[model samples]
Target: MNPVLHAAKLGVLRGWIEFKQMLKNPQEFGFNIIMTIVFLVVLYFQRNKTIEGNDMALAMFALPSLLGMLVVFGGFMGAATTLTFEREDGTLLRAKATPNGMVSYLISRIISVTTFSMVSVIMLLMPGLFLIKGLADTSWSGWLLLLLIFIIGILATLPWGAVVGSLVKSTASSFNLTMLPLGALTAISGIFYPITSLPDWLQVIGQIFPVYWLGLGMRAALLPETAVLAEIGESWRYFEMFGVLGIWTIAGFLIVPKILRRMARKESGSTMEKRKQEMMSRGY
Candidate 1:
């Protein structure tokens, strides 16, 4: 068998195994539980409220948008932090020692992040079905569309995540690099509110990133047609959503491998040990 193909299979198997193990890990399991509770709590409070122009409960509006954000977050933050930590621990170094190692590593990250995000999505969606009223009516097509968004959203964000991970010096820096920017984008991206409510320039800036498009795609997937009235141009603008996401996806693919190659070249036992020593010095 070909080396890359064999590596692909190995990566897939490893990714699945890691995902299964994640549920058994206390910290990972607790994150899922805490995330579900936090989202549900917020949705519970919003159940009584409605989008300003629409009869849809704010919680109903938010749930899917938050799901979209999770897809992006899982791909971006998930890959970045994982890469940064693994690099510090010498996992990347080990991978770099093998044939087609980066390919396998990238594939595994994609699979792991995709599965983890799906679990998080379901964790929120299951209770959301009971907690939020409007969602009970979601059709099979809506579920399909949601899945499509997840796939696209992952492709759009994960490479960039890997890029960020490769550039950052440490896991702590990865969080600082990813989180603060993500928070700012979330504020303007309108995951909890419609972008139509944002200022004109902010709206343009918001639409430039994958977050807004992912949220828009989710809303299109799950919300009633009438909800478009609250969106810009009063339409779903599926063209723009895919177009923007496609650009990001293409851009990520073009740039990530080069970045990863450089990062991997710089990875060695010494680099890993240096990172460990720095962490020790900081009492981490």
Candidate 2:
């Protein structure tokens, strides 16, 4: 086998092992459960409410949008947090010491992050089917479209997450960097409500980010055609959704490698030790 392929295979195994470990960890497992519960609770409260212009249940409208938000949060925040924590703890330095280690490390991180995100999506979608109405009305084609949008959403966001992780100085800073902006974006991106209800300027700003397009794509998959009436231009605009997400995907792919390479190059034993000492001094 090619050396790189062999390394990637090992990385896959590593990612699987790490994912299992995460499942075993009480805090991590509890976090997943808590998140799923929170989503269900929020949707449950809105189950009886209907959108103003349409008879569709608001919970149904928000369900798919919430899924989009989960994808963005899982992919972006997961990648960013893992990178920052590992970097601080000298995992990057250990990878730097091995042959083809950076490649393996990157592969493993991607696998872990993708799998973790998908698990969260499934957790929300399964129970949500019973708790929320109108979600099961999709055809096979609609389901396929949802799957495609999901893959694209992950690709669009994960690399940028890596970029954010690489730029931040510490784990705390990385969390703040990714989450704060994402929270604000989610508010305006129509995850919880219709974008058409927001101010036009806010709608334009929301459209500029992947979160809005992700939510729109999800809504296009799950909602009835009439739901488009609540969207800008009274159309799903699949073309624009793909166009914006594709731009992010292309830009992230082009940029993440350079940033990762720079970050990896900066990893050394001395630096790791220094960071470790600082972490200890700070009582972290």
Candidate 3:
């Protein structure tokens, strides 16, 4: 079998095992499901509103952005939390001692987290299509567009999870810390609102990150063409989104491995012992 395929398959199998583990401990996934429902419900109520001549504008913007947000959030936070928890518990150290262990472990994490995100999207889509009449106009092409952006956006975000996972020392801290950036990303990403209405500086800041582009792609996927900015001279904005997301994906590929390797190199038995001791001292 091809090496990459072999590795990926192994990763996927490991992911399945991880999914079973997650199912056994349902709090996180449960919370995520509830949050998805809450968000969709909010949008459902707002379905009667109009924006820029489009009814159910908030749903159009929120649903796809929520898809990207949920996936990115799941990939980054899930990996970070799992990696940090394992490190604290010495699981990562044990894995590190195995041949090709680190690669397999990280790839497994990516697969598992990606799987979770896809599942979340699938669960959200049923009501998103049928119950949320706002999305009634969304077509097969929109779904395809969403899938493409999601795959790319998830790829762009997953490696950052690696870096975070390798660097963090505790699952507790990982859970809390990961939310800070993610919450900010969701807020500024134009998930619930239009980026155009944001202050100039914030819009610039939003442009600096992938969240905006992902949100824009999501908007493009779900919103009517007239609802988007498509002036003849400024038509490039839509094309620019793919370019921006692609650049981030490439940069993440190059940067994340180096950071993970460095983090791995910094790991030592003594460091693990110290972490264990610290956790014990904290009574966790």
Q: Pick the candidate with the highest lDDT.
A: 2
**Comparing 1 and 3 by lDDT, which wins?**
1
Candidate 2 total steric clashes: 0
By TM-score, how accurate is candidate 1? 0.97
For model 3, state the Cα shift of residue 247 in Å.
Answer: 2.0
TM-score on alpha carbons, each prediction:
0.97, 0.97, 0.89
Candidate 3 lDDT tens digits, 169-189: 687778777889889977876
Ranking by lDDT: 2, 1, 3
Q: Clashes in each model (backbone N, CA, C under 3 Å)?
A: 0, 0, 0
Better of 2 and 3 by lDDT: 2
For model 1, residues 186-279, the per-residue Cα lDDT tens digits are 9999899888889999999999999999999988888888888888999989899999999999999999999999999898888788888989
Model 3 residue 242 lDDT score: 87
Clashing pairs in 3: none
Best of the two (2, 3) by TM-score: 2
How far is 156's C-alpha from truth in model 1 (Å)?
A: 0.2
Where does the lowest 10-residue lDDT sum fall in candidate 1? 130-139
The local distance difference test score of each candidate is 0.90, 0.91, 0.75
